[model samples]
Target: MIISRTPLRVSFCGGGSDLPAFYREHGGAVLSMSLARYVYLSMHEYFQSDGYILKYSRVETPKTLGEIEHRILRQVFEDYGIRGVDFNSSADVPAGTGLGSSSAFTVGLLNLCNAYQGRYEGRTTLAAKACEIELGKLGEPIGKQDQYGCALGGLNFIEFHPDDSVTCESVPITQAMRERLEAGLVMFYLGGTRSASEVLRKQSEQVKNSKRALGSMQAMVRQARSLRAEIMSDVDLIGPYLHEAWQRKRSLADGITNPRIDEAYERAMAAGATGGKLLGAGDAGFLLVYAPDEARAQVCAALPDCKAYDVRFDSIGTTIIYSD
Candidate 1:
């Protein structure tokens, strides 16, 4: 049996610019961090002679990629030549929650398959391969940030060059800055989850035509790079930058925010949060807030329907928990 664990990510800035539609022309960058929460994938050879057994929260079956009903899993297996294995996958949080859970799952599953095959590759290569599977092979309308963030955790700035070269840099934050960020940030569940692909597809189509949207995405990437520098020097400004990025992010897609999400944002702001935003593709999932310790109570009170969690930034990305 082989098990691989990959952390989910919270993109702090530069969310939309990583899409190929935007990056292929203007290049892109994203600043994000992984969390302790993870998607765990366990794969083992099935004693059964004929077929593959797959298990996840919603889908379970003894079928190959073509035979399975879940599109994501089907594509995943097909890309990896994973046929005739018993795969059981689960996560710390539910899927479609804008937490980059799907990418984490893909990374973890690939890691497990590599271990089973006795193939050793660095995190960057593994991340790139996963990106190839999802974006290149599967043709998913997504960006490179999620896979890279999940594979190489920590507070990082990822640069997507025009030539398809990806570079990961660690944010040089001081101890005091880390404390302030951990104390001030809060994540709350927004009562539902969403598949980011659906929203990203629309954004992709827009970027293929609208120069305005493409320009806006490029501006967001610049802001993200600037924000990373600020975070390393002075963490106090993250709140304002987060607000600025959120304002720009909402402009990328019309469905990025809804009444409920807007209400949550307003409540957090009213409760003394300096700023915050819905974490991923944004229709639903987790909302990240920057509230000082003293205002945490007020923030909690403001969002009655949501469950709040105090999370610290995870420095480790994906790893093999147990193998062989």
Candidate 2:
């Protein structure tokens, strides 16, 4: 049996810019951190005679590639010829919570498949293949940040060039500083989930048509660069940076923030949160707040509407936790 674990990602800024609609012309960059949460995949031969035994949120027993119902799995399995194995997946969080759950699973699945074939792929290769499978083959209208972020596993500045080349630069942060930053980040769970494809599709069209949106994304990329520099010295600018970035991000597309979301943001700020933003494509997900440790308690208390928790950073990307 071989089990692969990959961490999910929280994109701090420069999100929408990673889409090809924007990056193919202007390039893209995002500062993202890998969260401790993970997607775990365990695969081994159990009952090989009948078909492929799959367990995710649902069960599947498909004897042929065409019989598979999960789009991502179907494409990956067929393209790679992966079959006749008892494969099960479980996650620390549910899908569509803006924490890059899908990409985390994709990266983990890719790693598991490679390991099954007696191959071990590096992070960049796994990330690029996962992107090709998702953005190229599956036609998910998402960006490249999640793939690289989940696979590379750190607080990094990921760049998407017009030539289709990508780069991930880790933030020069010490462990003590990392813990300090993590402490100030308080995440509140918003009730509903959103389809990232729906949101990204709209934002893609907006970026192609509106210079205002493109310009906002460009500013975000700049902020991501600036934040990288600032965080290493001291995290004094993170709160205000998040505030300014969220304000610009709201202009990318409609429905990124709703009445309920706006109310929550206001309450968080009123309770002393210096800044915060919705973690995903934005209709609904976790609201990540930046506040001093002293203010975190008040921020949580103010948001009686949402469940809150602290976030931890993960430095390990994807690993075969158990292989034999």
Predicted structure 2, TM vs. truth: 0.98
What are the lDDT scores of the predictions, listed in order? 0.85, 0.89
After superposition on all C-alphas, the RMSD of every candidate to the true structure, in Å, is: 1.8, 1.1
lDDT of candidate 2 over 216-317, digit per residue (tens): 988998998888878888874788888888999888999788998899999999989989888988888899999887798888889987998778998999
RMSD in Å for candidate 2, one decimal?
1.1
Instruction: Report how far residue 270 has shifted in candidate 1, in Å.
Output: 1.3
Model 2, poorest ten-residue lDDT window? 45-54
Name the candidate that leads on lDDT: 2
TM-score of each: 0.94, 0.98
Write model 1 residue lDDT over 1-324, tens digit each, in one string.
Answer: 888989999898899778887788888999998888999999888777467788887556654467887666677676667767888888988989888888898788778878878878788888998898889877888899999999997899999988888999988787788888888888999877777888998887877778787777878899898998888777768788788888888877778899988888998999899888889887888999888878878999999889998868778889998977
Deviation (Å) of 50 in candidate 1: 2.3
Please list the residue runs of candidate 2 whose C-alpha ends up more than 4 Å from where it truly belongs after superposition: none
Residue 64 of model 1 has an lDDT of 47
